[model samples]
Target chain A: MNYRGPGRVRAEEKPMPEILHPEDCIVKVLRSCICGSDLHLYNGNVPDTRVGSTFGHEFVGEVVELGSEVNKLKLGDKVLVPFNIACGKCSFCRQGLYGNCHESNPEATAVGGIFGYSHTAGGYDGGQAEYVRVPYANFGPTVIPEGMDLDDAVMLTDVVPTGYQAAEMGGIQPGDTVVIFGAGPIGIMAAKCSWLFGAGRVIVIDHNEFRLEFVKNYAKCESYNFKSIEDPVQFIKQTTDWLGADVCIDAVGAEAAGSAMQTITGRKTLMQAGSATALFWAINAVKKGGIVSIVGVYGPTGNLVPIGNVLNKGITIRANQASVKRLLPKLIDHVQKGTIKPKALITHRMPLRNVSDAYRIFSDKLDNCIKPILIPPTVKE
Target chain B: MEKIAKGIPDIKDWGIDADPENDPTYPMKPNRTDEEQNGYTWERSVQQAETVEILKSTERPNLSAVFGTSVPPKGLSGAIRRYAYKNSEGQFSHWLPLLIADRVNVVEGIIDDLKKGKVPNIYAEKGFNAMWKYNRKAAIGMIAANVAAVSALGLFLFRGRIFNEGKSVKKALQNYNM
Candidate 1:
């Protein structure tokens, strides 16, 4: 699926990518996912998104062709490719901050190269195709363990790791109350993962009725529609004995819909790159000196935020693209033990050809779409 | 900050999670003994033997630890790209010809494919089918522009004959009917 500006995606056949570097390998895409971050490009909130670019980052594929230097992976090995395209030799990657690799995306300083995230992210085409040329193949791609469902394997690429990182960054102390903003997949997963970090209670905030209900059952956490509540920040404080939650997470970024001001002036880019309604809420909703961990995708530029409140409240802000390469082994163990049901999160599984319709359904939130997994045409049913 | 809270606060909820036995996440805490979290042992991949000619940037002191073996510099477009690597990447001289060379390489690839008896599907692969199906207005406009260009070229190529035929007809009319 190629991005045709905002709110439009088209499936088109193209030339097969060749080995661009010795570290690169051509992976036949078995499964790719439509990530929440993809919606930023779909809505044209992300800058430097070219018209012809493909927009998928979470994928698992079979290594059909290998470059000469890739020694860890062999031809025909199935691997779960992380969204972060990090070269392991980089200083950041050496320090386990693989998301901020220096060598992979030499042009940027913050987050490193990402697949199909547009030119700002090293201009690499995404895995939402028949085949994708994966650079730095030796570092990030982990061979999928035996009997692991492809759906579960693909979620491990981005959503699970991001959700895990959000909770991990919060520094959640034992018996601390955690409030997560947004009931999207990442938000819901974050709520679930918080329990692993000893969260006393978890609360998810969102305006979508279906998503709220889904998270209630799925994450087994309290869920509320922000529209129905008087105010989300006030509600969080009220529920937490007027002290606010210990840790607040902003899982909703850029396109948060609660505030009209944020939508028009921020997410619409009238005044900022994207909306910070959720970030604003998270900041104001947390207890003094509480952590605000953000894993939601945002533009590389600035946003209208209440920095004064952060100073006064003494909040600790932790945000970054998740370092998937750093957290995969433990997550795999969790999946193997059935401690986390990653596959249960997938609500829609559609072929890559129907990506246009799938994008519409997901964008419009039609048919209770939680997360859609896109299967390439070559995969057997 | 109240002098760092004077060691411990006297608040009602103070000193929570201070004991390991009472900590809810005690079982969930990081186990340093776990082999996975411990200092992991990894090996650097053996350097790939460079059997093909590789291009290195002028800015770098040496070639990368690894370079691509596929599509080594060979044809005319490759020569242009090879020249591009001789200059600094910041220069337009290095990048502009690269953009031109990419399109030039496509034509070279098509010719090579023809030599191998592989008919390349330029139309379908170029997204014409997608454009016509999704955005018909742009497709129709592109078709019209192509047609006009071809007609103009045909007229220009046979302009002498067309003008000569018109002049002969006028001269014949002057002699016959007057």
Candidate 2:
């Protein structure tokens, strides 16, 4: 399937991307996952990738080729591509923050520009193609642990790591109240992280009843429908003794409407997905002397923050693109120990040729699908 | 000295001698005949020897000749005496009068000189003090007139109603011996 325009996909043939750098490794797609962000671009919500950009970010694949200088892995290694591209030795990566490496993209941050995005991430084509060239493969690509299904490992590229980062950055301490805004896939994943992180109570808010119900049932978190509730902050406060939640996650990113609920008590933390607007509200909603961690995607233009307010409140803000490499090992351990079931989040699966339909179904929220997996045509059972 | 020179008139003799008590019959001086009052009374009274001495030593014509045929002098003393007193009269009634009027002309000239340019070195060092005396009198007169008009208006309009009430109140209290 080919991405032509917003909600416009057609079948087309194109030359496969080849290894252009010594650190490059070409991966043959085994399975790829559809992200909510991809849906935003697919539905023309994001302006850059509207016309014929390959559209998939979350993926697991096997290496088919490597450049001359590549020595980390041989061909036929199953790996998950990081959502952000990073060179391991840079200052950011040396500090275990690979999302902003210096060399990943000299023009941009080390945050992986997936297979199908625009020029912001070095204009390196994304992984939605049959064959994709991975830059800085030695530092960026992660090997899928043995016996793990490509479908489940695909989420490690984006969703699992992003959700986990949201929870981690949100400061979900033991017995602390965590309020997650938006019941989208990332929001649910954040709620799941809160539960795993031992939050005393995990509350999820969304305007979509179906997604809210999914969060309530699957994530086992308290769900609030913004549409049904007259006042979400008051309602959540009533349960939490009029003191707002200790941590709030704005996983819905730019799509989150209006201002976030103001946190009156405790050390409030806001975990932003990919929205500068969410970061703005998160900055406002946080309590004085609180912390805000922005894991969302920031374009070249920096987000406008009320610097005076942040300074007056002594509010600390930390932001980086999602660093899957740092969180993947723990997530993989959770999966192996059976503490977390990554596959339970998937609601749709289709073949690679039927990718256009998958985009439509997921992008439009048809059938209330959360994470949809696309099995490559060449992959065998 | 010199026997007090009773008939010799000096600079002090150059003035009008109008004595109201001496001429109390009409309260005015009666007009006298040209011969009696010719030249001046003081000139006719001077001694002949002094008149002749003054006339012979002088370079100009005799005072009798300068006075012409209007009134003949009684003698040589009369001529010199008439010359001295007539000179004093001339100083006050004609040229001296013009000199007084010329004081204003000199003041205007000084103002013109100040307006035209800076005071010349010669005038500032020599003439400035004498010129300023007359200028000062004129300036004071102009200033006093302006001040008097302004004060009169102010006292008439402002003090008449307001200050007069205060004055009347004090007067009433004084009448009550308080």
Candidate 3:
């Protein structure tokens, strides 16, 4: 699928990619997912999202060809390529910070390369089609172990690692009450992961009734519909002995819909990059000296955040892109052990040609869609 | 070394990583599997004698220990990339033009492929074969949706000419009076 602009994508035929670098390899995609972050590009929130660019960041494929310097993997190796394209030799990669690799997306500071994202993320075409060219193959693609489900493997590429990192950043302690500010796939997974770190209770907050219901059952946690409540922060404080919850997570990012002021200023007017409604709630809902972990995607531009309250509360904030390469070993073990079922989150699976309709269904939240996977044409059955 | 630990017990976790094979990063970072641990085993690789034009990073003081035989900077996109390398990779001027150059390089590759008498199979490679074999339901739905869209567009565009007694939409509505 090719992006024409915001709210517009079409299926088109283009030349197949070749190895342009010594560390590159061509992959025949088996499964690809439309990530929540991809919606940022679909809505034209990301800058330099060129008209002809493809958008997908979660994929697992079979390596069909290799570059001259690629000896770690050979032909016919099934692998899950991490979204971040780190060059392994960079200072950040040396420190296991693959998301901050200096050589990949040196387009600017901070963010590293991401496949199927805008030029801000190294401008590499995504694996929404039959094939994709993976750079830094030695550092990015991990061979999928035998007997693993393809659906679960694709989730490991982005969703599993990202949600795991969000919970890990919270530093959840035993008997700590955690409140998550979204019920999306990542938030739902984060809720499930918090239990592994010894959280006493987890409550997911969302305006959508279906998502709240889904998270309650899937993550086996408490759920709250923000629309029915008067104020979310007040509710959290009331439930947690009037001191606010121990940890709060923001998974909604800049497109949060709880505040009219944030919607207008951050989203509608484009005055700021995106709405900080989720950030506002998270900062005000946590206990004093508590932690707030954020894994949501936001624009580079600043938004109206309540920094004063954050300073006064002495809150420690941790946010960054997920480093899948660093967390793959542990996550794979969890999956094989039947502890974390990533494939259970998938609600829809459609062919690659139905991408436009699939995007509409997911973007509109139609038919209680939780996650959508796109099957490339190259795969047989 | 034991004099300092004369009064203390050795723990299992303290020196567990003494074995070089216990390193965690080498598994994921395949490019660094042969790297010198702690800079104690450092050694330069044998240089390639191939005289291919190489485009090394400006940040590097000299050529690398080994380089690949990639095509040199020659085409229009290649020229732009060479100029882009003059600036730091972190500069936007360096990356924006490089992105545009990638698209240009695609067109150049297509032209080169055509010159070699190779043509891409649009119908097969574009997934029509899969539609016939595995996704007939989706293919039919797509066809029906496209037909409905075209029919609706045709009726709206030729509304003035198709109607006999009432040509315009307003006149047609008048004919079917309430």
lDDT of 2 by residue, B49-69 (tens): 222122111211232111001
The parts of candidate 2 lying over 4 Å away from their true place are A43-50, A109-112, A257-287, A296-314, B1-178
Task: Show the lowest summed lDDT stretch of 10 residues, model 2 chain A.
Answer: A262-271
| Over 4 Å off, model 1 | B1-178
Which ranking of candidates, highest lDDT first? Answer: 1, 3, 2
Error of 2 at B17 (Å): 99
CAPRI tier for the interface of model 1: incorrect
Better of 2 and 3 by lDDT: 3
Candidate 3 lDDT tens digits, A1-381: 876555666676767877766778999999999988888777767654555678888999999999888989999999999988777665556667778665665334547778888755655689898898888887789999999999999999999988877777777765578899988899998888876665667889998898999888877789999889869999999999999988898988867889999999877766666888888999999999998888888876567999999999999887878888988998999889877899999999998987876776677566688899999777776
Q: Write the per-residue lDDT of candidate 1 for residues A266-380, one digit (tens) a residue.
A: 7554356689899999999999988889887777556778889999999888888888988899888888878788888889888898787677667656668889988888989
Residue A369 accuracy (lDDT) in model 1 = 83
How accurate locally is residue A54 in candidate 3, as Cα lDDT from 0 to 100?
A: 80
User: What Cα-based lDDT does every candidate model obtain?
Assistant: 0.75, 0.57, 0.74
Residue B79 local lDDT, model 3? 79
Scored against the true structure, residue A258 in model 1 reaches a CA lDDT of 91
Error of 3 at A254 (Å): 2.1
Error of 3 at A262 (Å): 1.2
Q: What are the iRMS values of all candidates? A: 11.3, 64.4, 12.2
